[model samples]
Target: MVQGHYESLNRKNDERMNAIPYCDTGEVFEADTIANVWKREDKEWLKRTQSDRSGYEYPRLGESPYINMTDDFRMEKKVICQDIFWSCDGTSFVSVHNDFGIRQYLVPEESNTDKLNRNLLLPFTRFFRNQSIVSCAIDPFYTLYNENSDRLAGDRIVVGGKNFPLQLYSLMDGQCILSYDTMNKINGEYETVYSVKIDVESRVYTGSCRNKVAIYDKSRRDAVWMNQSTKKASKGRQSIISCFEEQPMGGQALSRGSLLCGSYANEMFQVDCRHQRLERLNYTRTVAGGIVQILTSDNGRYVYVVRRNSDAISIYDRRNLQHELNVLRLPFRIHHNSAKLKAYIDTAYGLSMGTPQGTILNWGRDLVEFGGVPSHNSVDDPLITSIPPESEWRTNLSSTIPATVVKNCPGDPELFALSHGGTISLCRFGG
Candidate 1:
């Protein structure tokens, strides 16, 4: 009976593997040339075919002026933004800065390009903290309204940073709403939580120093579960975790929800929440540099990994974690610090990433509708490459891209990107 069950499992696995088509890596070109050519071609194609198609116009790629200095700052040094996130309603956004300042700005409904270009994006609310915020997350359920126009759970954000535990802050009044003790004592010191993520279930996951992951609910201050394994790696002890993301549940019948994490060693792993143990994925092996970010699809079907000092972003199938789905290579180098990526897979299927060269690179995935379904490539061509940014822009404010946070506004065909140097770029899909 056991042998029969094993055979059936193997058959199912084979069928699943055969269903996915291999992505083809066609002829490659220089980054700048690719972007220029794609823009030209896209314009030509739209001009020819858009007249026939009604209702869905492609987004216009445009930019707002550099939102750096305010009228009060003429001689002071610029404050570097560490991270930024858009609210669920897309009406406002919050930015975390290296100077321990958090600022919130409301998006104006009208496009006042001339007025905005002449001035900075002034914040409506500002909060100050003693420690620099490393990462933050908004409440998933915190939206502006309900079906009857009633206010829901809104105006709350959780932040984790240097020497402090995860604290929930109110966006309305800029007050400390709650705090979660995600830190733990290791040896003689307390570990600082570096990454924080909130899920639909109201649970927060925090990744801290010494490769630790802790789970906490808003109702309690103590961590519900903490995982700290001391397994020796090929190069001594493991490094701290850099990021955390919720992953999809696999096909296993006994599987529980999983939390994906990346470490400073460029290694990826999943924590089975129910089992409370670490599970290795196919890409668990270490790479050259640390992981910059791990972006997963909304439905959790795909994961895109960005690594430090690497020119390529790897795409993976959530179901088949053993093999990569495709590789999107960029022309510019991703520096060891201050790089970010935002990927979308639905109707607007594409990705945008920031480079150390002060440029934001974007690529439109060749899907069935956008660019007819791709044909399978030969085994010799393993890479299913993405064309260079449909839109590429370099900032004039700073030499290095300190922090690149890209947020896609819901219900709109636009993108908002922020740099640590206090510049903001607005890109519309077509226009």
Candidate 2:
């Protein structure tokens, strides 16, 4: 199954090369104007600029111009990035650093010369002292223009921090729009919010912490429902709900109060936020490992659960939670400290995972045929396929840089993977 997979040789070739050929244009042009026409060297240029403006040059054809290079974006930081999220349009992405600073980068519309020059293009960055952003969610309903007045109202980003208030910021300027105190004394004092999800249409947000989950309604400017427990037994069994995801049904414009969450108690459950009390649709306890993350299919039919520090993932059918459809195991151990488990299931790529070993593994849907059968020898099971030497879809990053997040770019064949060391790689499959 791994045959025909290709690994990008751009990085390897970049290290052994020194200089690229270029046509030195004697005239100078503005940086923006030069960047606009840098790709077309064959076109006639009518210079209307002074020599001191900025000397410009264009790469000749067949010279392996840097503009044709595939290595899109890369950045280095003093600390490992905590999390990275792509915008709804896939044109930009935001990454959070351990030092409570947030950096947003624009996905270059055109390829660039080098990583340093690419980053020096002035990305949007903001820092918050004494506040470490734990989770962030982009408002799905936000648009550039107001519906009523046709005026511009910028998009908003919701962010949660450790022991800090849940704050909303303008996506354009990083200015605070609103803030809510999420710390609750009833569930467990000093409990920090670890997860947050926003229902943009409803203008409501859900936050999960140590032993409680709170739903804040933007219209009311207060929590509509806050679940907190005071019982001793509840506290003992209570586990932090580290992950929360809204599973919007098919044909629904917005999520209809249905949410899926994973807890440290080794359980995966669904919650309905319409009611005042905690109402569950389905709950199941899986393997001994804690539930690290929960992901749903585009149709909301299948649920994939990632286990912390475990090599296996449990897949369940949403209609029937009595038993898991299948339990698929990986070849290597996953990083326990990794906050997010990147998984995507689509027709083109059945199911792909970015592992801690810096490899993207594709476990196609063919394994589902082995369901309901117990294998006598786990190692020799036909369902378990190892990474082969050559596959058209597999990519092996450096062993030192573990891929913390992997996401597919919309309307394109590209897959973006962010490493633990703050490096982002763009890979094209089946091209």
Best-performing candidate as measured by lDDT: 1
Question: Which ranges of candidate 1 are over 4 A from the true structure?
Answer: 1-77, 112-120, 144-152, 183-188, 236-238, 246-256, 283-287, 338-349, 365-403, 425-431
When summed lDDT is taken over every stretch of 10 residues in candidate 1, the lowest stretch is 20-29
How would you encode candidate 1's per-residue C-alpha lDDT over 1-431 as one tens digit per residue?
32343346445533332111011001111112323322343354455446645676533322112223234232133444566666656666776655456666666454534422432244556556655567787765454342423433466788877666678887656678787765454454456777777776677787876577788876578888888545434573246777876331111112137878887766677876687666656345645467657766544567777776677677777777677676666776665543344333322434555555554555444321222113333446434444334445443334454436555555453445445344444443331
> lDDT of all predictions, in order shown?
0.54, 0.49
Top TM-score hit: 1
lDDT for model 1: 0.54
**Candidate 2 segments exceeding 4 Å error:** 1-77, 112-122, 142-154, 183-191, 200-203, 228-238, 246-257, 280-287, 338-341, 345-350, 364-396, 413-417
Q: How accurate locally is residue 124 in candidate 1, as Cα lDDT from 0 to 100?
A: 53
Q: For residues 285-402, what per-residue lDDT tens digits would candidate 2 score against the true structure? A: 4334566677665556777677766776677777776567766666665555654556554433345666566666554433322231222336454442322211223343455556
**Pairs clashing within candidate 2:** 2-390, 2-391, 4-391, 4-392, 5-391, 5-392
lDDT of 2 at 90: 57
Clashes of 1: 9
lDDT at 322, model 1: 73
lDDT accuracy of residue 178 in candidate 1: 80
